[model samples]
Target: MPNVSKCQSLYSALVSRFQSENPSLVLSDTISSWLYQSIYSIYETSGEEEAERYVREAHMV
Candidate 1:
């Protein structure tokens, strides 16, 4: 089972790291909202493994 809180925390960290690393690139609120929705949808429909995989992939690239 997926721990949604942990996932949320990890996601937040990932966003922060990305923002710090790429200071010039601004992630607007709309984009963050869409990404969060997409991630949550994946977790609900695809299961924990897929959601984790997606997060890992997102972090990598």
Candidate 2:
């Protein structure tokens, strides 16, 4: 599984892409707070097994 920093970087990249296409939408603190919660939830709930599964699935793709 990727470390927290790596995940954060990916999240930032995703946010950048969203902002680029939706110029009128601004990513404020609230948006970031929600994103953090969502990301952490995925990690906390799925744990290592799910992460490894996802990695393998991605490799197949």
Query: Cα RMSDs of all predictions?
Result: 3.0, 6.9
Please give me the total number of clashing residue pairs in predicted model 2. Answer: 0
- Against the true structure, candidate 2 reaches a TM-score of 0.56
Off by over 4 Å in 2: 47-61
Error of 2 at 19 (Å): 0.8
Runs in model 1 deviating more than 4 A are: 1-4, 59-61
Worst 10 residues of 2 by lDDT: 52-61
lDDT of 1 by residue, 1-61 (tens): 4567866865676677677778776777997887676667787888767776776667524
TM-score of each: 0.66, 0.56
Best by lDDT: 1
- For residue 29, give model 1's deviation from the true position in Å: 0.8
